[model samples]
Target: MRGDSLFGDLVRAHRRRLGMTQEELADRAGVSVRSIGKWEAGQVAAPRIGTLRALADAFTLTGDARDEFLTSSALDDITPAQLPLDPPVFTGRERELAQLSASGDGTIIRVVSGTAGVGKTTLAVRWAHRVRHRFPDGQLYVNLRGFGPTGPPLPPGDALRGLLDGLGVPPQRVPADVEARAALYRSALAGRRLLILLDNAADAEQVRPLLPGAPGCVVVVTSRDRLAGLAVTDGAQLLLLDVLGTDAARSLLARRIGADRVRAEPRAADEIATACAGLPLALAIVAARAAAHPAFTLAAVAAELRTSRLDVLAGPDPAADARAVFSWSYRKLRPAAARLFRLLGLHPGVASIDALASIAALPPDRVRALLAELVQANLVDEPQPGRFACHDLLRAYARDLSDRLDSPSSRREAVVRLLDHYLHTALAADRLLKPHRGLGPRRPATHAPGVTPTPLADSDDAMTWFGAEHPILPAVADLAEESGLHTYVWWLAWAVLTYHERRWDRRDWIRWQMRAVAAAERARDPHFQAVSHYNVGYALCELGDLAPAHGHLNTALAFYEKLGNLAGMAKVHLNLGIIARRRTDYTRAIDEAETALALYRKDSDPVGEARATNNIGWCYLTMGDYTRALDHCRRAVAVHEAAGNHMGAGHSWDSVGTAHLRLGNPTEAAACYRRSLAAFRSERDRQYEAIALAHLGDAEEAAGRPRAAHEAWHRSLAIFTEIDHPDAGEVRAKLASREVPPFSLRQQIDRRP
Candidate 1:
């Protein structure tokens, strides 16, 4: 029979001999009747010492009856040899333990948190054992299973029963109401210096009831998550555990298998230690296996562990087996927590709290609380502050669980929800960055399976979401492609491109554009493919990679031409002209610009015609054909103004000013420059405004107003510097010349003549 069962049988025999009913016996012992049944039936062998004591007192037993009960409850048979109390002494944990121990006499709640097998539980147990003597009344230990391979977590009521029984309360006496029972338990230990060890606690809610009221008692909890709520609400001291050091693992091995055996097979032992990945439980199991078998070499054990550590560790003793330990914890979680754990494993990369909230479609605060529960169970690790990650092994297990528990449709829906969240967020950011651009036709809202779309309050909220989620956008794009979310892939690419261009993230621009192009092709949509190619070409041109830009643009033009899309073809031509102008090939620039203008006019696309006209003006200005440039730029401005394209009007005004400045018409140039600056300022385009300011300064200088010119130049230079423009170098040069001593009026005239 199991040790628990044997002990239960012994309790039953004593209770029967005393002629006391289970309830009456439980009432005197201060425990639940169910506990009495389990104990008597030998189903639960290890009734706590206090519970056994309560049973003894209830029976009013004396002499041999009490001795037999005490002996039967003793864990001597279950305790293997030395009991592995030190459990492969952890290295580099002195500082952590010291911090935990020194957290003070007030309800000292320290959480040793880490990924599964990262030694959170071992560290917590080690620390508890070390500090056990500090609490003179005795120490209490309970495992509030948070995560495992089994079913849901044991209810709080069940945990309270165990705790009350451990504290010498008989089965029937323990209250069914968890809160009342906990309150009574706390009141019982009010003035005592008890050390409570709540191991693998599921959350603050689970641990809250078990907390003793005595200021002298210390509570040390261990988990795999941050448990921020516990610290925030309960003032619990948070100590996040990490992996054991190589040296510590080596020492642990040396101590377990003997210094000579380890030294002789140092490499093998090191490998075994490394395979454990600094998980003390894993290390202890391997060491114990080796210790039990003297003939088995460390090298042999190491090889076996490397081949299948999980299988090897899934032994009968849950405490010594990583998988068993995890399973035990898993068996004790709520159904919601178990489902959440599995779903989270389906995430392709590290998910932010908000993303998780959106995926679960739970209230943000509630989702956060659930995540905290997972952390406490030692199933998740908070590697960085506010970010949780599972071990790679645990992640694999979670994924397996997800596959088994969730249907393909459900999994697909979850993925779609995550993708849509990113896509919508990116779209909002795009609108915020380029408010003037006509937003594309909205796709019909298709609710993800099991998920509803969250409404964004405003552009500001959207922008904030985008900013926070920007780091993970690339991963989302990759996931979209992998998941065959073609439309989402391209649209997300387009949305993020707006922010990337605004921020001048050239690398990301290229990356997303390539992804978008592939997605567009998969979608087999000509319009989207054309747009993707055009944007890719644009980004390439920005990076000075004209060959690739030409290739992409030429391909895009052919597609448009085949479709008889004159407007689209015209836009491509206009872009080609801009590229040619950048390359200083003015003739080619003019040709492309003229072709675009003719096509736009034929198509009667006003926006296309205005853009083509602007390109023509820029080409002529670069070619020193100032008169033609001025005429084209003025016409472009009129077209754009009529179309209500304020940004386009700003560009045309700047071009017209440049043409006038080159033609030595300062009065006309100043008027155009001021108009350009006003438009740019109104649009909040600081970079363009700075360029206009510089041109205005030049026009003032040419008009023979030296003091006015100086002021304008200074203002322009300041704007350039504020915007961190590359052209600030030239602005500074002009400013330096202005600061030089001026020639007299007669000398100035002579020099000019």
Candidate 2:
């Protein structure tokens, strides 16, 4: 019966049975009374061998009683290995694993935190198994059940008891009081190199009590909650886990199914990775489905996932169901934050604070607080400072919640506010980008309540804003159209057109403009329809699709002529002239340019006047009328400079250079080209800058400065290649052949009035 007792309990009982005090026992064993006290108190798991021998002499034990005591004491030497089975197929987290391992010199308390089903526990367990040798005393693991399916989070006291048990402290010896138990746990771990893994901890409070005060132990706590308190008070290092990357996600899928199967359907594999939103749990669910149904192609699985992400990601276990798992975290949020989370699903992409505020009808500061809570819960991420994004699966989950909980009218209102935010902000940014090019009436200073557009500092700031927000602009336009904000659609397209044209992505420019054309036709707005058609035509010309470009231009011209919009007609004529020149119809180019110039003069627009004049000068240069070309281009340059239109002036100067080159004045040609290049560089017009550089190279070669010509050509080619311009091929050819083409390359005429 006594053999069943732990060594500490046995020592206490036998000493009392013999009617001896701790001091008397210590004297008999030739040890201090403190040592006897420690054994009886259960603070020390087992006494040393010498101490055991001394205790045996002190107790004067023999036979079964003596053998039982020694046997019980010897059992304490067995190292506790409470770690769960190593993750069967751990993937990714290479950086996280290294972070866990690199928590330098001393007691390490690393908190691995992430969203639900992001594989925090797997990463912790995998890393624990890897460095288990360093903690030779033992490795202890406990799941605190923070966001589990069953009960509320495990209490700190209960978690402490479980950890103590794993450390081999008997139930009777473990203290009932949490603080006392914590002391006993730390005492048990003192001087031992152990790895304590507190998995699924609810918060810092749940994990703090279980940490050993001793220096030799390493504690890893994983949770969905950020556990900021633990990091702040306990000096714990945090490793915030994100979803798996493309390569790792694919690899995980391959490992579950077969690599050959994955390789066979790489595109489907990519689609699965994207649809899964890189979440390891969702990926695992997909992998399971694909493995279970060998007859199913990866494409079929990927298609299923696209239609119902959360549904396809569901599993037999409720704990693994993405919807269920996400709900656990969602339920913990406060009312306002939970509502914000729901509304975030309405946002198509990364949203700024003002956009969220407008959608939620809350102030920016209040929205920030709610967003912070969401971020702490790992339901939202600040992808960039002041810009929040949700995971795709989470967005799907949030959208589902919004559909069920929020009213249809409320959702529509929120979408309206969201569109208002983007449209107004984009217009303000556009105004800064092109102060002279007003497509329609000016935007009013007033906005709807709770809708605050982002304030841009200057043109550079405007350019920066567009660069960050361009990818989402088209999506916002789509959202606008879906919400029946038809006018917002074309305006959104027009707002971003200036940015698109100045940048090198002609294909995207054409796509957005086409969408605007459709929206304008649906809205039955002829003016915008004409504008949209004209923009599409301009973009098509840039891409060398001249036939379609000409068609769109003529359609725009007819609409403008019908509306009697002289200014609009002027813009169409200018673009038509550029198309004619591209087709080498010099006569038609001059006629169109003359028509545009007359319209600009009638409209009293100086910028359009200069642009039209420049187009005529280029046409004349193309036609070998060098004297008239020189005269027209010089006047165009003067008007452009006076009007403060650097871009127009640059084009005029390039035209002037071409005329001079045709007139056999290489030195003057080079000077005009350099001036043109400077103007393009000043405006950050990279695409035009490349063209100007090419013109400069031609002038330099004509001037018999082959070395300068090559340098200019090299710089031009680099820029063209960088921007993915179609002319990069021609530049490459010029370099390869070590010769400039005959001055047949005309400067690009202005397509915008």
Candidate 3:
């Protein structure tokens, strides 16, 4: 008979001999009738170890027959000559297994722990298989069903009874008392070298009674937790199983699906491994699917798996079978912990402790304790220090539970409070960092005090805050849009804009500007919309995209005119002048700048007037009118100084220095550059500092001081490199043409001056 027909014949013959129908076997095994039929008919050739054990129990198959059936099922297609197995093909766990195994001799109770699908069971099975020969008596295996939907874990007394019966103790002879049964179990394995494998043991209490006290025996326990109590109390060796190495995952794939197939589809195989995230259970499921369907390419399977993680995780197994594994773990969580786990799925991104606390509105310390419980249950993952994220599959499961457990209004309120927390904190930071950029009228604050609505102390604190929170900002923006919280979206967008501008992040500038514009449009707020359009246009001009810049700027100008906002109109015209200067339309640039300057003077907006005057100087410089440029730049500098704006003063002085350089006045240019550097440093603007340094280098060279010029150029280059500026390449080119002085020489210049 063929392999399938032979397996079917054996299953049928075994069932009939045991006087059990397929339905009876299915009921006893806690599986479906169809699944049992498929197994008997060989349509589904391999049953899980759990199903096989249930069948064996129902059949009353004991002694050699039971052992032979289990051993054959475990062997699968391997020949009798290779029946013992070589190291059981362990992957991603050499060091851990070796360390655990080397923890002295005797009946070492080693516990392997990790999050779900992290290969805890695989390591235990592999380690047990390696030392099986050392235990000459026999090897015993049991799935405690610790994390499944069926119920609580199999009681220690029951597991002990199975082990006793497996070692030849008849059911009638088994003791009813738990302690007596445990004692009997220890006696059964006395002086025998038996290797006991307890897969998915719930806790130390469940496992302690089952351990054989005989010095020659060894026991391996696998669980989805650290089992710290077991280590502290029982001195059990503990091995924390992490994700597999990339190469080992590839090797696992190659083993199941031919090496040639893996090589032919290397990229897809890599993607499959990454999608599985080095989890053994996931990889095994994926590889098994690939093996069972020879016609389905690995890429096709990988693509499908990426779209639906839970669906792929279920694999060819029935939903019931997959839930059996997950529900067991879920059942073990406390009521509050389980609720928190489901609610956490509502979080928009990787969860921080504060954000989680804010969403739950619980004390930080209390929420942290609950998170620990969920972590212990393996329902959540604490991947890095103070950061927690759930697997995509687990997150989806949690989301489903959230919907089932929480009211719609409760979920909405939780999400709203989270958004409010982020918005209020961002506003606070914005106020502290850019106090001059007035955010018209303040909205009524609704968030509570524990949320801590305050900004950091300095620029460094601001940078750190933005950097740490950057990953979640976009998701927060998305949530704001979804929740129809238009004001929150636009204001948050505006606040983040300053950080992006300070860092010269063109991509983020464009992204947030677009979001701000959309939010403004949704709110029908014309003034805010005009501001968004203007800033976005300015960014486009900076990026050298002129046509779109002109279009957006013109749209913004029209909006400002309609709203009769003269300040907004003047700012738009000034930006337009800058754009025209970049396009080399000096005449149009001069015209726009002059008009903006006149309007700013009329409004008595000194800051606006100074900015417009600086633009006028820039236009003249582009047109090769050095005298005219110098006159406007000087006026702009005086106006900026009178306004007490150090940043504006620095820009004006830099322009003045450039005009002096063009006019061949090295001494005047150097003086202007020195003054500009002082202002730029005071403002903490590195970009301007680099420009001033470069100007100083040009003036020094003009004064016939090559060594001093080289020192200045090298200093500027270092600044460029430190800031990751695009101009670093240009600075490098300049450095390569000259014998640059050491940076140490420039550092000592202040002492000499």
Each candidate's number of clashing pairs is 26, 0, 3
Question: On lDDT, who's better, 2 or 3?
Answer: 2
Candidate 3 scores a C-alpha RMSD against the true structure in Å of: 14.3
Model 1 spans > 4 angstroms off: 1-84, 87-107, 111-118, 125-196, 202-217, 223-235, 240-337, 350-395, 435-463, 521-528, 625-628, 656-753
What's the best-to-worst order under TM-score? Answer: 2, 3, 1
> What TM-score goes with each of the models?
0.65, 0.86, 0.73
Cα lDDT over the full model 3: 0.76
Residue-wise C-alpha lDDT for candidate 1, range 1-753, written one tens digit per residue: 222245666677777887889998888899999877866654443544566677788877789878887765543212111112665455557887788768564767777766666677667777777866666667777777665544555577787777666566555445456665665477556666777777766666777777776687777777655566788977888877766777888888778778888889989988987788676767778888888898998888888876776776667765566766665556556888888788787666666665676677666677778887787776776655666667544665677678877999877777887887666656655665566564546442454543433455654455555656677778777777788778888888888775665444667779989988998899999878888898898788766788899989988898888778887788788879888888898889889988998998898778778878888888888878889988999999998888877778888998988888899888888898899888766555556777888888889889876666777777877876764656789988988877534668986677574
Question: Judged by lDDT, which candidate is best?
Answer: 2
Query: Which 10 consecutive positions of candidate 1 have the poorest summed lDDT?
Result: 75-84
User: What's the CA RMSD for each of the models?
Assistant: 11.2, 6.4, 14.3
In candidate 1, how many Å is residue 750 off?
A: 36
What does the lDDT read for residue 224 in candidate 1? 54
lDDT of 3 at 531: 85
Task: State the lDDT of candidate 2 residue by residue for 1-753, as single tens digits.
Answer: 111236668888888988999988978889888866766766545544566777887888899888887766742465889998998887778888899999576788999999988999999999999999987888888889998788899998898878777766666656566776776677677778999899888878778888888699999999998998887998899989999999999999999999999999999999999999999989888898888899999999989987888888787799778899999999989999999999999999999998899889899999999999999899999989999998899999999999999999999888988888888888888877666776556344455677767778887888888898888888888888788888888888888887887787877888889989999899998988888899999888888899999999999999999999999999999989999998899889889999999999999998898899888988888788889989999999999899888888899999999999999999999999999999888767779899999999989999997767988999999999987998899988888999544432242233224
